[model samples]
Target: MILHILDEEKFLKKAIQIFNDILPKDNVYLIGVNNKKSEIFHERIQLDNMFYVETGSSRYKRVFQEYAERADIIFFHNLYKSYKLNLYSLIPNNTKNVWYLWGAEIYGLNPRINNILPLTQKAYNSNLPLLKLLRKRVLSKIKKNYEWHLFKKILTNKIDYVLTNISEDIDLLESYIPNGTSKGWFTYFSFSEQNFEDRIVLKRNNILIGNSSSETNNHIDTFELIRGKDISQRKVYVPLSYGDEEYKRVVISEGRRLFKDKMVPLTEFLHLDEYNSIINGCSILIMNHKRQQAFNTIMMAIAAGCKVFLRDENTIYSCLKREGFLVFSVQKDFGGEDAMNPLTEKEMLRNISLCQQLYKYSTVKSRIKQQILSILDEQDKT
Candidate 1:
């Protein structure tokens, strides 16, 4: 039996699709950390061999041990700390274990635990108050020092392989691993292959900006810059949760005051098909985070053939640039003597055009699928 632990619905759907294609027809079992509705919904259509696991931190150890005893291989979707303490060390040494590095688990919110306060100070100085608040809250809830220690502990385990969606993340992992060869670190692109008939009719001429709440800090300043420029055509779409109401209200209110009738807000959790349709219809996607552990959403938008605009300094932009994916623009800080010079409109437009062309040529989605399958194949061989 192959044990697959999934957290998000999007990832669960994609993983199930790939596992069904490669694994023995009835040998795969899905253990989800989501509600029963999502698990039943996913299994109802394509994954007949699926098994539901309730979402929790304390129960994971017992559940994982029970499943690990009977399973030939175990795959954890991401290297979360709860899993690190419960499952990583407890899994039998003989069973092949694969760790999938997504965003937060690897490149954490700050450079180091001690740097959290300083990072928030920088955000405040940069006129990104919203981001500072969000960062502060996250820092308070999850201790950076403790998480870093847990992350290091998990890395010491005998993980057979590490699969990452971002190529840049391979280098990040290498910093921690001893034998830092590509043999253990696999680079895969981000892609979701759920085919949706294009429902984007382009009813309006607005640029659509979509993000999860975790990214508020990175994007707050960019939105401010665009707002100052009198850019009237802007729409913001973020998935809503109870904790995000205050921040969401602040952002939406600011956008409305700046753009007037041009700003629109979408806050509901959209179904996959509906979300895809909305994103596909957007004119451009913008991300302005100073440091992003991973920018899967940007890649997903690019895979959907949408033009993307991102700050040049981000790790994701740097990696995309190295990969020859011309999908971003670098914003330069102009203070002191260099204050007079800034990026020209023509230069920015040229980069956006290049990004659109590159999107057409890129096989990001296929690359992700290939990496997942490769991990499964390696597990089978061992």
Candidate 2:
């Protein structure tokens, strides 16, 4: 059996589906979330053939160690102190291990943890100088130091493969991961192969800026960039449903201050239907993440035929552009008349088609199956 150690995330549902579809059999244990929330979340994810351990119980040890050591392969979706149960060292030396380099595990290794406080113009830290000092000098260091220990101890020590959406991220972690760890690429979503006829249209109507209150979204800078433009014809919507609480307040304050009543701040997490409603209604989507974040929303916006804007610095921009998707850059292509225009019908159709073909579940499943089978074959030979 292959054991999948997952974080409590929406993507895991898709991951579970893909794994179950490809792997002969699999067991899943979701950690990185409160045990109290487990059953409800399990229902929410609509999970099966899986389990999670209560926080204070010894069940984790008995469960994790038993299946972990017995499994033919181990897949880590996140790195956390739960290592006390599923230590990479405890698994059989022959067990093929694949570490999915989800963005947080990689960024946690950064001292800043992808903090975008600078773009807030000191509005956040200025009010909480003492709090900022504690975070900068004490808390941040402690967090990164612990994560560095995990990086050196588990990730670099014996992991066989590293999986990420971007090769550039693999390059970024080159120095930290061991030389022998091979690369495998995976994106969270799988697109449908169904053919559909819908013309991409952007009339510069409802606008979406940033997906969360996370500092990396740089919501303020995104706000500032579009502030100079005439948005009288547009209504700006910012998704702050989840992420940093204080940062959410900061984003909401600045967003309203800049865009006034035209700005709609999403304070509560929206259900799928409500969220999709906003996404479908919007014609323009602007994201200012310095790192690769809010990818699900970004891709959804693209598939919905929304005129998407991303920072040139984000590797996704390069990747999408390379894949022949019609995407724009926030810095060079975000302001004035030209920025608001939608793709031509041909370009829109091409983008929608390209997205489905490139990320088709059938293709992704085949790729994942091949990668897993290669490892199993290697094991057989040895």
Candidate 3:
């Protein structure tokens, strides 16, 4: 049996469905970590093999242990949360483990080639809760304790596969896994379920800014960059659907103050089709993520013939450039009098071709299916 553990992201709902299509229903089991969100997920999926834990309940450990015994493979959806550290300790030394590297979890911990430690330290030193920082420090010390490190090293050594498309992520994950036994794959962006098409070339006008309300997007700086530009006629759309609410409110306030009627803040949840329509309307998409966040949004914008701008420091910028994408860097185009530029026909066609080649639904679906099946085959051999 394959036991899949997930955090409370709605994308994992679709991810679970993809797994259901690829694997035998009886062999796959899902456990959601957050109670309220998991209940909502259960309502949507209603899967017999799925279980959501009741917070602070005695039955939680019992339920998880029961599934753990039956599971031949334990799959961690992402490796960020310390909540699962205790649960991971319970898995027998024999069980094979797999981890999907979400960029934040991996890159936040491992900057690869970038010297981001000073910046990160400075950010942490700002007006964050003292108790929270103290608690995190204490936790870090505990995790670094010799006995705890030995235990963690044992568990990490059992990680059979670390799944990620990013080369830096692979290197970081391998550093933790003993003997560097973890295998890497050029995995597709597994969460995106958009029906990608070559959007008709039009006179693109509006600008799409920031993927989320996360501080990683450097929203304030990017907003300042475009604030005084001669593009009052152009609309600026910011998707503040998920992330820090305080940050979202700040972004909305600042955006309105800057663009007034032209500022569009997507404060509420949007259905997939609705969001895609929003993407289609934009001519320029600017994501100022310091890491590899908002990549799916960037790809969607590219497929839709939007002139996408990402920071050069972002690892994905170089990766995409290597893949023949016509992506512009914010480092060069820091600010301009005319910030809103339409994609030329030549640029549009090239972006469309690249987007389809890399992220089209059929390609991702097939590759994921093959990768998972191959993993299962390897498990059978063992």
TM-score of each: 0.71, 0.89, 0.82
lDDT tens readout by residue for model 3, 1-382: 7887765555666667666766756345445455644323224555678776653345756776778777777777765555555565566666667777676554444323232323323443353478856865686446445334443453455567777666664554446544455565534354243444444648657888987776676676777778667675788888887776656766787678777889989877777688888888888888887677776687778778888888776767877887888888887865654446777888887778777777665677777677767777777788
lDDT of 2 by residue, 1-382 (tens): 7787765656666777787788635556555455555423234554565675554356755676788777777887756444432464565677787788766655655664454636674666664558675786687788677767756667656678888767776776774554568888766676656553443444447889888777778887777788777789778999887667788888888877888899999887676668877877788898887777777788888777788998887877877888788899888887657787666667667778887887778887888888878876775677
TM-score of model 2 vs. true structure: 0.89
Task: Please report how far candidate 2 places residue 117 from its true position, in Å.
Answer: 6.0
lDDT of 1 by residue, 149-209 (tens): 6666666655666775356666756665553223333333333333322422333334555
- For model 1, state the Cα shift of residue 86 in Å: 2.8
After TM-score superposition, what is the CA distance of residue 36 in candidate 2 from its true location, in Å? 7.2
Write down the lDDT that model 3 would get: 0.67
Clashing pairs in 1: 326-355
Model 2 misplaced regions, further than 4 Å: 35-42, 45-48, 55-58, 80-89, 112-117, 175-178, 194-196, 199-204
Residue 43, candidate 3: C-alpha displacement in angstroms: 6.4
Residue 41 error, candidate 2, Å = 6.5
Residue pairs with backbone atoms closer than 3 Å in model 3 (clashes): none
Q: Rank the candidates by lDDT, best first.
A: 2, 3, 1
Top model number, TM-score: 2
Candidate 2 clashes between residue pairs 3 or more apart in a chain or in different chains? none
Better of 2 and 3 by TM-score: 2
Output the TM-score of candidate 3.
0.82
